[model samples]
Target chain A: MNPILHELKAKQWIWNASNSQGKGHSKRLTTGYEALDSVLSGGFPSAGMIHINSYLGCGELRLILSILRQMPQHEVAQANNKLRVFIAPPFQLNAEFLLDEKIALEHLLVIKPATQEEALWSAEQCAKSGVCEAVFLWQNQLKHTQIRKLELAALHGQCHCFWFDNNRQCMSNLPLTLSLLLSRENEQMQIKVNKQKVGWAKPAINIKLPFKSRTQLRFKEARKAVNNIVQLRATP
Target chain B: MQFDTCSLWIYLHFTQLHLNVIENTQVHDERELAQPRAIYNMQSNQLVQLNESALQKGIKHGMGLASASLLYPQLNVHEYNEEIEKHALEHMANALYLLSSDIVLMPPNGLVLRAQNMLKLYGGLGPYWQNISRCLSQLGYRYQSAAGFSIQACKVMAKCKQGIISQERDVIEQQLFKCSLAHCDIDLKDFEKLKRIGISTVDELSRVPLSQLANRISRYSVGIIAELRGQAPSKVTFFAPSISYEDYIELLYDISLVDKLVPVLKHALKKLETFLYVRNTQCLHIDVSFYQREHEPLQIGFDSAMAIYRHQDWLEIASLKLEQVRFASPVYALKLVCEKYEVAHASVDDFFTHKSTHIETMSLTSRLASKLGQQKITRLNFIDDFRPEKSTLALADIKSKSLNHAQSVFADRPGFLLETPTLLQQKIQLIKGPERMICGWWDDGVVTRDYYIGQSQQGQQMWVFKTPEKDWYLHGYFI
Candidate 1:
């Protein structure tokens, strides 16, 4: 048997507690980016922490949009798996935008935690609840020492964490599987995947974004007509 | 084998009369039911006794107050108060149940324990008895018990008497022995007479032959003799009798406290429904009593099945039942007892349809009902009279209806039919159509209306209608 599966099942039996009470190791958080996923060893679902500093200038939406684009619908589907994605306190996964992107909203649950502890508690609950796949967390920035407990919690829960630290710095105790230092290089953002177990061709990779052209005016016009019809029927 | 039937009329059996308890209860203190229990009785310690306890030494049960006073100078006796002692009894019962489940009470006092199965579990009667004694000592009940394979032997062991009864081997002999029998509680009166006849052993009694005892012992005694011989059967008194639904709420000033019992009532009603279904029974009478603050209990009898049957139905009925109950005090505990029951068979198809239809209908109706209220929830039943509103009408589940299949005309019904007709209200500027529809004359009410399908500037469609009186009314809209 897999060690994690065995440990979980063993814990279940020895607890002697009825299943009515929920397990205490669940995690429910928002994942930040999609493309940086390849840099993650076991895709962030390991025993460590990684600091994400988005160098998207114009700038934040630039990298955010690119990262969102790189996220494969299949991976998103698998990671979500009947769990509704909850954003930060009082924020929800943008329902309309997610639907437009073909994201399944059925399993996307949005919860608002009043405190940081509550947010962590929700994550622990999700992990121990034996439900959901990857958990993503987007916050202003966590202190370097606080990341240690978070990494441990994620490891214990056996789920991935994509933590966004807006304030850029090289502090202490980075349990991140992927030590990324995102910077603007050669007019395009460069994502340096710095850590052990770097796969394939290179330890670093760079890519140009806005991979779509400003073509198809007729298509735009067709969309406008359809929207007009929707608006016309709004009053009835 | 000591029974001489010619000498006795009544018979009974007593089991588990341990020596330790006999000594403790009789020789020592009798205030065992209250306070920090006075556990053991010291030998030759003469303590003043309660008058009732003193009377029990040699006096009969119901002697007058004057006779009792004459019998004992300062008889400090108190009547057996069941209420105060109930908690103590319950505690003892719980402890005893942990040790043995089949501990049947001989009532007001005494207990009968079956030792056959336990003998193997505990590795023999001796070890079992020792464990029980240890447990009793721990509980401070300080009681004694005795066990034997046969009823007479068991009784004799408890009472410390050497009473006996003959055993029967063949079915013919068993039948001949137990034929003229009357059943009753275990009364040990016959065994007393047998000892009086100078016949004390069961071995001697068996040799005397069944025909001889037939003329001597009463049929009751004969029954007891057969039971001892493993011929007469013992029916357990543990089965509580089944009755119709009855419940009483007393001193219910706190509705929140009574709210806790709602789920319990649901489970009980489910069991009752299951029971009724199994035995093919139907109940028509339901009664509940509610007692107010230290006042007499007020009762209401619901004699119609249509009044309430299911749990949901009962909620409303209970509210109605409570409406008549005037509260005098905050209610502590309520009791519900149903006394009458009758058999009624349910067909297999009806039984199956009842469940599946409930599931199917509830799925659709609950969603609709959640949007609406209880009064608005409905299921499609055929109209008994073909008329508008009467035909395919909506009625509260509070009112039961039977489906009529004959005039059912909706051969092609739409799935998303409106719960109720939606009245159209739109900016009716773009299009207009008041096309006429005259309906409901031939079993479908006499109706005349000019219906209109209109499209607004916003591209929305509306279904409007105009009566023959030129009264324009918006009916509905096609989104």
Candidate 2:
């Protein structure tokens, strides 16, 4: 059996503390972008939390979405019946945009926790249940102990936990397997690895965001209207 | 030749004879400590039945209270309430009815059942017997059980404490032969004459000729012997069980603490499981009411989206609901009511097998709802309205609806929609054309706006809208 598949079935981390020494030997999740994958020496770490610190409105969620798009939907569906959970997102989750990005809407769960405590709890529960492939938690000012608790839950469930914390101070002293500092420089989203448990790192990978044209936007609207009209007419 | 009555019968002799009615409702720890306690019948002015301690102290049943009090100066005397005792027996019967429908209420303190059907129904005699015993034990009853080919044989063997009787007739006969004349429930005058004639065991009595035995003993003795040997059918009125599941416990002492109520509720839940099992149904809802003195009854309820029959699952959810309940007054009585039942569906494993996420999410939702109240947890669903606020509905409202994929028609919308539009602060680059949404005049909330996809200076994509005059509002963010 494939090692990753076997580990997932057993609900244990594929790379434990003892065997996570060799950076080259560690199993990685491909970012789907060849350039970023080559720079990170394969891809992001498959298990444990990956902390991303970025300025507000700096395409932080977009960067993560790019990596998620790389993984096949069937693999995730088969791994465990876990959905993609986004907890206490900064903005209201627009279902339409996610569909445009090719994300399965049924497999995406959004939870809006009213308090920071609840957000941490929701994240931990989602991670510990092993019913979610990825838990994108947007919580600000989590203590060291809270982050450690989340790390342990992620390790035990063998689920990928990503923390999008805006508070830079609280992000430090965390057990994040991979920590990246995201910034916008020269019209490109730059991702610099500040911490790597795998013992090796590369220079910042400047990812260029795709720009949409005016005609393409109008074409999308006209096409949607046509489809809706056709559906409306098709129904009795 | 022996009578070939090929049916298994069970006799349940509730051993703690005196306290049946009172103990079922209220736990009497003090009485338990005062072991040599005698229940005095007020009308008779006599000790009806004394516990083993009182018996050891030379107190006897039907003896005058004065004599019993003289024997043990500290003897605890309690007024015997026949109604309470009868009610308790009925409750026990109802709980046991789940095991077998053909139950006969042996008045005062016993129950008889046709166990042959239950044996096959439960797959075999062993599981069937264990199921009844476990349920009885869980219901907080003290009883001795014996089974045999005939109900008479089971009753006699059980009264003699002959232990569990196998379904085989020979084993029952062997057990009956072991019991002396003194243990058999027969008239005292007839028993003495039979004892004098060397008829000690039931086997000896069975060998005596009917005419000869009738001449020495009463016809009742002969009838008893005939029934034990399965020669005559005992005229028994099998108890019909109540349709609904309900059980009550009266606290010996009024309890102010909520935790103290858990054990009683747990016992009631165990009975509910039996109630469901016998009916071949599952409970979807249960209501618990606490009877307090001089106060309105405090009621709590547990409801499952899916039908559940397991005792532990009910207890688990009840405990969660109980944690949220604050007792205003000391609870005196507790009752568990489950009037309605749904047909039991397939096993739980099938419902959760491939839908682990759905199961976990459900559990999460239940936990959050329990802790944060039911109104707190919600989800989003889209409507046909163009207005952003009116376009979504709370998921909890339409619980039965399945989550569907977002239609491609709404493809040009942003990832997040603000509840209300806020004034745009930063200059943004226009990446796409203004998609004009100009409907909604029919409704009270009318809107006409030009919406565009814009990228902020920090590379964040946003959905912005401009109205008739020239005011720009940030509708939502892409992420």
Candidate 3:
């Protein structure tokens, strides 16, 4: 092979087209949901910034909670007793739910900055501080440079950052390891992969939730009663 | 007198302490020390201390102010302040406390240090005196020092300008014998009586018997002679350094902007660093008070996540805190006070862990707290309570012990709770049945509610509650 072609291959400018598992796909964490994990190649990337855009409470935190529960179980994370920082959550975090899920309360930190700039800054600092295992940031809006800086910070600290945007605005073109948009469809939660580093963008996938809509349950109960009446009339 | 033969005492007599302290406390200028300056005693109406230039201009001590002014027309006179001079001596003693532990303050400008123990630590008298001299030079004071077997003997030699710095008994006694009676700490009438009796030097005074001296001169003079000869023990009180740190720096010119205070604050923090570093202790909080021209002093307090003693760390936090302060008036002085301290312990890191980073968790939290308010960063701890609002507690300090046994009655709860319940505006499909709760009946108010997990039209999961009156309100979010 020519030296120029070899250099291109070394720099990863050219690679095999059929290679399904790339560099980023090798190091991923399972999302605890089998269907969602399959759609996310293996799971979410082990490190770097992840952007999740959704409505205020469309199972976004639940998706992150699954990964957060497994973080401390990792060998490296367990050794350091790293912290999980939450910067500017929408409301007061329920301690009962987190404790029930077996999250270590001692390793949890919540920083409610007064301004948006302070929130972004606190998020970046927590991500860049290597003492943290993960940093979850909830903000209304973020600029392109801020996202890039946050990505670099997460990469440097080797900590995973999950940024939740609930403004219902169109997603801006920003560098990220993975970008997800979440919604609810009846009894299932829909997750669409908008951007992924190593794989092609996937279509929307629905995962069944443990919660059932009361209206749907009521409709089914009414239909069963009517069927019982019809069955009785036919028997007569 | 029963003198400890194994112990040695060193006395430092600050000759021009009043003038030196005035020069040192004022802002330094190139021409300030070059000009003729003298400290004039208002009560005596005479010159008490003269700087080098004033002495060179023939301005002698005890000369009347009119004659001193006639001798040097350009003489800059500062009124003698006994209180400031005493304070200056104490300040010097505090600075030298690190070198020597036992210090006795001889007020209005003198210090007596027990040097026998320190000599052994420093290995020799030469090195010990060198260290003391270096410290005095940094303090920028003119002083004469001497060593002797007794405190009074060293005081007499140092006051007479003998400048003898030795640990050996023979050398100190020889120097003490040569001290002139006129320059000693004796009354004018006693000096005259001693001079009339042909006792101009300490050597001649020691030759007279104590019984004869007691009958001839006053008892004070006889006692002075006995103490100088190591025949009588001198009453001495040792000075103890203050444990708390408080340093005040008055600016020569008022600074209107807070940024200009950095250099002054840095100097004060350097002093605090030495204070803490020597004791191997660290402080958690420091209060900085700025004295303005016309307003009440503004005091800002800040703290670290962990106890820290480094000057750079405090400087960084102070600068961040200063950024938030809006100066109401021009500040003329600044005071840094730290009353609490803890023993410093070396933090051991995991050797097997591979991640190496410059920032630590405590420092990061401190930096954020200094810039943002301290209340912004907190830890969530569960508290055993029936009400959702009282179920969790936010703690300011992460290291504080939290209630670990707090268990909520409700098995299923939302991840986020609204501060207060709001009227449910949108139509919702309830998924779970009402989990009824009757709480706070014995307290401020009664609360009877039925909670249900609901999904809104926009697909947002909400925790809603219904009152007995059939009114529904959104209470929390499942996210």
Predicted structure with the largest TM-score when compared to the true one: 3
In candidate 2, position A34 carries an lDDT of 74
* Model 1 stretches astray by more than 4 angstroms: A1-49, A54-90, A124-133, A139-146, A149-159, A168-172, A179-236, B1-185, B188-190, B198-222, B229-479
Clashing pairs in 2: A82-A131, A92-B416, A94-B415, B25-B250, B26-B250, B103-B239
Give a tens-digit lDDT track for model 1, residues B289-353: 54434656545454433212355554444543343344565544445445666766443565533
TM-score of chain B of 1: 0.39
Which stretches in model 3 have alpha-carbon errors above 4 Å? A1-42, A70-75, A175-177, A196-203, A212-236, B1-7, B15-101, B116-142, B159-161, B167-170, B192-218, B345-359, B396-399, B406-412, B438-447
Reference-based TM-score, model 1: 0.34
TM-score of each: 0.34, 0.71, 0.78
Q: Which digits, one per residue and each the tens of the lDDT, describe model 3 over residues A43-143? A: 87878999998988777777677665654335466456677889999889988877765567887889998899889888888888887888999886888
Top candidate (DockQ): 3
What's the chain B TM-score of candidate 2? Answer: 0.65
CA lDDT of each prediction against the hidden true structure: 0.42, 0.72, 0.81
Higher-scoring candidate on DockQ, 2 or 3: 3
The 10 consecutive residues of candidate 3 chain B with the worst lDDT sum are B350-359
